[model samples]
Target: MIHTHEVVNQPPPREGVDEFATDAPLVEAVARWGRAGAVPPLSEVGVHVGSAAFQRDAELANTHPPVLRSHDRWGVRVDEVEYDDAYHRILGAAVGAGAHTSAWADPGAGANVDRAAAFLLFAQVEPGHACPVSMTHAAVPVLELAASGLRDEWMPRLLSRAYEPELGGVGLETRPGAAPRPAQGGGRPRVAKRSALVGMAMTEKQGGSDVRANTTRAEPTGADDARGREFRLTGHKWFCSAPMSDAFLVLAQAQGGLSCFFVPRVLPDGSRNVFRIQRLKDKLGNRSNASSEVEFEGTTAWLVGEEGRGVAAIVQMVTRTRLDCVIGTAAGMRQSVAEAAWHVRHRSAFGSLLVDQPAMAAVVADLALESEAATVTAMRLARAYDDDADDAERAFRRLATAVSKFWICKRGPEHAYEALECLGGNGYTEAFPLARRYREQPLLAIWEGSGNVIALDVLRVLDREPDAFDAFFDVVGEAAGGHAAFDLALAEAQSIVREVSADAAGAPVRARELAERLALLLQASLLVQHSPAAVADAFARSRLEGDGGTLYGALPPGVDTAAILARA
Candidate 1:
């Protein structure tokens, strides 16, 4: 129920941090949301902030235990706590704030070499706390240094070992040849990013980014531009990561394999190489960041990894980005919640304090609960990333990433909106933080990976030979077998998944929904079959990034995505 209609906005008190503030529409709106009488739901503002399913997931996320307050140590505000630990650690922790994993390097991170084997095996320890951006920047030193140290003969091959961190934000901005540039720019300053991003990720496009169904092709070329060079890139690249990159990692189906061709720019020796960015996309959230719809008509290229290994290679790159997005999403949510909560504590309304209101109190509590839940899921996934993580554990890590991403991305805004209502008319205004939070929430689901993708990852676990699944759950079941009811529920949930899978008659539509349900049941089964205290305890220990996907450059066990040659 929206309260905007009943409450008119009141400007903020122009004094301190509220010094440059304006209306208090959000505070009044939330006050009205809790009040007895209600007017009409505002035409423009509507959020299913009251969704039970959503709220439930959020509640679970916050159940994890708290970690050492790393914010002060890391220099991040309270809002960015979830992303403080490389990849999935902070994410899983945010889900339930418990244990962690130790998976934050690629094949060549500057970590100790002898530790490489141990790093691969150390499923219980993760990288030191660092932001997603830092994590991504990490590869820079490793790759660049490796590239730099080369005897000038093997530089090209070393890029094969280079681990590029994919930072996927709706509108991520940065300038060319710059690192962590500025935060505020000269022109339109709303993006709040100083770096004029050279490579912006415009995630909104074609089939909404379904990699499997992607049609953008890179066929072999037979001609040259004004000045000649024999190379191939014969299709439109809908979403090129670095359209402006001097060299783009283009994924295309070649004669023999699905390959990533590192298309190098024609050296100005009268050579022709143009990845003409038809037009840059105009996105909603990360506006200052640029993403383009590119036409790679006859571009030049060279293969990076093996041919037909395109899908696997892309997945490798995607996996890196996927974790980064989770970290970034958590950071965004953290920012919104902190800002609104801080405002609520100081403001007064209806002759009492903002935090004092029963309505306000309940909503804030709910918001905190969601943040906590997301934190745990993310951390668990990070820890499970080591090279030695068994197949079952790895599947859980994938499922964990999806669960954390889906839940937080879905719920973060709900908290912001509720907090906005608490702020009243002022919150609705651009002057306050709630409105920005409101606009930013949609990007989380849409970015990194979408709700559908994450859900499917979870469903894949159940669909695997049930025993393979049980192989992991067996451990839990053995330890927790003392609880009769819990065991029964788990068995029953497995039955449900089997029943659903059996009935799926090769239909995509039915299969998708069923997959989501299978995952939902598994998650719910955890609740019924286990004691809340135990679940919470297990969750709290997941604050580290030492889980399944932690190993640098290795697939979790049984990820039998072994390349089957794609026939032409």
Candidate 2:
């Protein structure tokens, strides 16, 4: 019998990009920013993360979301969360690659940049698991404020590269070389472990971003010693992600005011703390990770910092996580562009490859420009963290983090949608990764803080730290020498700043617009300073000069679509 059915016109799979070897932009960004030494390890990590096996694991983890076991077979309230094997394997790979604790393990010039690059690459494979990794990394700074005795007891275990998912129960032994330390008042010692993960529980139902409005109460247990003061917390966390983590940095009202506390899952007597996981959140994406609504009824916790300074103690951690938000969004953009570019290059239409068509090329080039700008901006911010000791750099970071996080994350969902359209119907299905990426993009913008919160933060920095405004202009001015469009945009931003400074009441109303301008000017300045002639000129003309339309692929006539797409 003659064959009547065939699968013709179907594009070949867009695999074999050698995510590590073929990423020219990532390679260039690392080397140009003084992270050349980290190239070898980062390259290996990229390859592993991009491998078929690891990608399979990433999909499996998301498909099989974590399950909440409220009780065991005997009906005891355990509140344990069980995850798929793929979730553990991916997290283990991230921990083993030092993506979580690399900066702390080796503090030097390019350590933060190196770790940021590695994190960006790993996040491309699986962003859901990145929550715990980011929390663990950001938790280090907060933990340092604890008493030396408390710090010494937990820091070593947190720094471990191993991923331990086991929760301490009856007869769980302490790790080797670490002795069980007694709780305050010489109570039975807590079981010390070789590896641990950290999480955050903020934003109660009544107060989402207004953590000051939280109603959770933390009362002293009346047991104090050199180790630390103990407290019993009673509250409900509206959104507590990674509930299986060993410990959480929570905010609760104390006698003085809102205070930071370290709430652990396992108590000193090798018994589970009074953490009641009401239910796991049914999120839109990030299914591989579990976010829970927890109720704490006299949960055992120790004060992390002084009372009435909870925001101050946790602000640094928030800053670090916000930085990750930028990095994660940039990774999403890169993945979207890569998938779009691959599809167009392989698929043919109208007697030619889609990539060769002028209209399609314009769209691909525009997407590439967005991706490159985001990559460079994120790397610059990472470099800023490396020089925190410098007053000017610190000031620059204070303002720049808010601006970049506001723009880059907000742009992610739209960019992902445009890239998905490039694949036609195939991209809309779960069979492709772009659909998942589109859903994941919005979470980053909403995770650390939403649009208004970030924009208002920019105004806050301007009002509180005037030096940061100067520092921001100083950095952008370095790249403004020759580009007329960038210079004009910079001057416009200065004028807005001056006007906003003159009228304090109107600043809140204009915060989002001002934040967008500041971010665009900064991104244009970075491209002008470091990117290629085609990329820089196109971005400056289209974005800074306001010569482009609202949608993607609307670059003006002089823009070099071929060169930009080639770089992408």
Candidate 3:
């Protein structure tokens, strides 16, 4: 439902949405899922460590024949509440932008989150279906955040979100030698209270992807009125992707270090005080998924943990989101490309069906390769998450979360563009959903944590586990040893990292990019050698660099670069 960071420059897709018809089947699928039943009671929502539970929510109580179900706490009574109106409007925007725009997602594990978002949308608009599922419990910290930014004098609502029939149920992926315990003890929300029900809250500012150095601040606030519970946040948040949601699980620095807390936009006394939505800036892709520039003016808040533990509290949210973004974006492109290919097989061109054209065939082949590689990589990360975090859920909470998120989120969009190109001009236009799919994938890569930050996560981990780093590098060394072209490029990239890291005044950005590129190269090697969807080395590089190589001539001529790169 969120657009990645890379899409900031384009007009939001919602701005122009009258050009196409919604797929009846898709809408029906959403309706069918909605009408089937509510997911389950809060206690029953499955909580695992690794795998996803991308299934239909059981069903909710019917209020309006068509109503926004999960908007509140699986249907909080928002009608009497007085909060900023922005949150309510965002839902309509998301759907409007979706029409005629290429921002649609396909059915795939990678896009499990998008599917969940869509179900929410369906619940929102459905007339008779008044109830919604419990993504709120999944997204508690986020809901807390939204409520915080609002008023200063209302009783806190202890919401209970449906827990059963999770979309892609949970599991863990812990790492070895993790800290023994989280100081918060049992602060992590229950499965039914997870942040998902409220949508997700992600932060990956442009200049500070390295989350540890984030500039936001969280300070303790003494209570005011009896109902004015006290806490304070002062910082400049660049992007709250779902700006209109019930909550935002924000990260800010405190006396100890980086930590996170839940914030809301409304106070119980019917006020929109602490925070204000700056702008729903026009963006390149997921136009409906609004991102905002928000300034916290000593916002009243509640601390989720010790002052310095904001990062720790929020890391759980970010990591899970990061990995999920990958799945969502990649699934989007898979659906888009498959849709495009299906069109090509039947649509006629100059002389015959487009599939008959050799140029189109080659692009299809590339999409196939990229999709398979992304899928396998995503599954690997997911499974690893389940295994590693099996028992040590206490500390290794973000282990599987960070790894899978880092890889999948960035990679989903990378290949989404490749899939987009399979259709020429049709892909570029709102005439098809390719553009939207391309735009949506990057929401993962740049949000949560940009590709660079995630790469650094790997670097930080590897820095400590030199043996692990060595194992990875040894393979990289062997793979690139003979390929002079790859060797030179990679070595050159490494040298750039060394030089950047060597600088002190302002070298982090460059250093981060180098780290990201390094990670991509490492994964590329891993995929090439072992992945079933392993792309040809030269072909991938050609696409990466926009080099006019062998596949260039083989590919369809009209594919857009923006579209192609968007997939990656």
Candidate 4:
């Protein structure tokens, strides 16, 4: 008798792939350029992130998005966002692995690269919680610019590996003498927790990226004690992410100008600050995290730096977060490629495995190429951050960060879509990871800055920082002599940079084109210098030599499909 309900031709679940080991590109990239001793920790974290339990948590977190509790039953205005246990677990795991504070905890050669690798690995498990993690990591540098007293008090807490989620409930007023204060003999103020997470409140209703148009005001509270100058912030923030964070880096108009302030959830008196989470955004993605509209009515804050220098003070944090965006996108791409490749290798169609089919092989190889390029570029940027003493590296990063941010992020959604297609119907369903990956891919491009905003930032660097522009070309130029295709691409990129620099007024019109070319050239150059010969040859021939088409799977003949898929 024939079986009526046979599950025929279905591939087994793509489990047990060592996320670090199988990711030849990421593993090789880290080992080659990242810190010499960083692999063991990274490998351990990679194993955890790729485990079945972690993947299940990722699915549960996204499936059960955070719920906003604007008020208690008695209308107490609690404004607490409640997330599922999975969210907390994943976040705790990430924190425990030092994804947030590793660089600060161990400041040495390749420290940033190690941190970046950890971040990329953790983000592969879940992207939502990475928001606060990224912000908290980035906030350390900005917080350093604060008064010495404030820095001393907060740095230890921020660098702690512990993950604390307790929130001092609203309306539970703190008794006057209960809150921490300086010791009787004028010692530093005490902190309440072992670890703390930082969030960001920027971009208002009227002004998106035009932060200069912000109308929120910060009024000095007359107190001049050593605990740092007190201020009462009164304004509405249109986009405040991770509202439950211990403190936030907010921007507000001060007497001097727009300045950065550290606003806490609970005031020094142990009473809840006047931070009102108006409403949580129903975003397209990043559901595991909370992004809210917040109101600050006399909320207590401390100036991070001199008033009117908010932009300068927060620029470094923004740069760091932008790097996370690049890494996040690269991580998503890597997952997509791995999933797609696994499916094709195991699942058969007609008389052969999908991976053996010419059409399917081409698609998987193309995706692998994109993912490898993105990984290399992102890791290179991280390596640049590691060597702060090198002015040329610093300058190169200044320009390349913006360039990679624009191109890599913009390519994520398309790459994810192509990879998802390789699985056909299974990839389109929520049961498969690709559907979620597809949704999460766009957030990176839209988060820190939109595509155009990032491209313009690249242009701004070229026009203002001549050294940075030259530094960018210098790095890309090193790989010029190796490949003719790269040589041609580099020459064209230089020409465009010159043309755009000469005509600042017309630069905006060609910003995206220029950014794309520069990004492609940079990726090609890096691949030429570091990637496997097959991978580098394919990237150069397709991306650099104009042999590619608008769609994926357009890699020309003669490409090493098996070698590329093996890496994937």
Show where candidate 4 strays beyond 4 Å: 168-191
Query: Could you give candidate 4's per-residue lDDT for residues 1-568 as a string of tens digits?
Result: 7898988788887665568777887887888777787788887888888888889999999999988887666555656788999999999988988889888888877788888888988887689999999999999999999888778767887898998786532223345666554322222233456678889998999999999999999999988565578899998999998998888999999999999998878665545667898888898888888899999988889998889999999897999999999999999998898888888888998999999999999999999999999999998998888745399999999989998999999999999999998889999999998998898999999988999999989888887898998898999989978888889888888888889988989999999999999899899999999988899999999997764467888887899988888788
* Lowest-sum lDDT 10-residue window in model 4: 182-191
lDDT of 1 by residue, 305-333 (tens): 45566555555545544555554444444
Evaluate model 1: give its TM-score.
0.54
Q: Write the per-residue lDDT of candidate 3 for residues 1-568, one digit (tens) a residue.
A: 8856654322222211110112222222223322232222100211110012111111111110111122234342221112122322322222222211111112223233223333222322221111112223234333333333322211122231212222111121224543222211222121211212233333446445556767777766666343233568787776654444444566777666776565654443323336555555466654433446677768766555555666656654455455445445544545555555566665777877766666665566556545544443333333323322333331232333444456556556656666667666767875455666666566656765676666556545434443443343454555565344456656765576456545645554554454445545544554545432224353345433443233422543443432332232
| lDDT score for candidate 1 against the true structure | 0.39
Clashes of each: 97, 0, 106, 0
For each candidate in turn, the TM-score is: 0.54, 0.95, 0.53, 0.95
Model 4 RMSD, rounded to 1 decimal: 4.1
Clashing pairs in 2: none
Relative to the true structure, how large is the alpha-carbon lDDT of every model? 0.39, 0.87, 0.42, 0.86
Question: Rank order by lDDT, top first?
Answer: 2, 4, 3, 1
Ranking by TM-score: 2, 4, 1, 3
Model 4 / residue 31 / CA error / Å: 1.2
Which parts of model 2 have CA positions greater than 4 angstroms off?
A: 1-5, 169-192
Candidate 3 wrong stretches, greater than 4 Å:
1-207, 210-217, 222-229, 253-258, 267-273, 391-414, 465-568
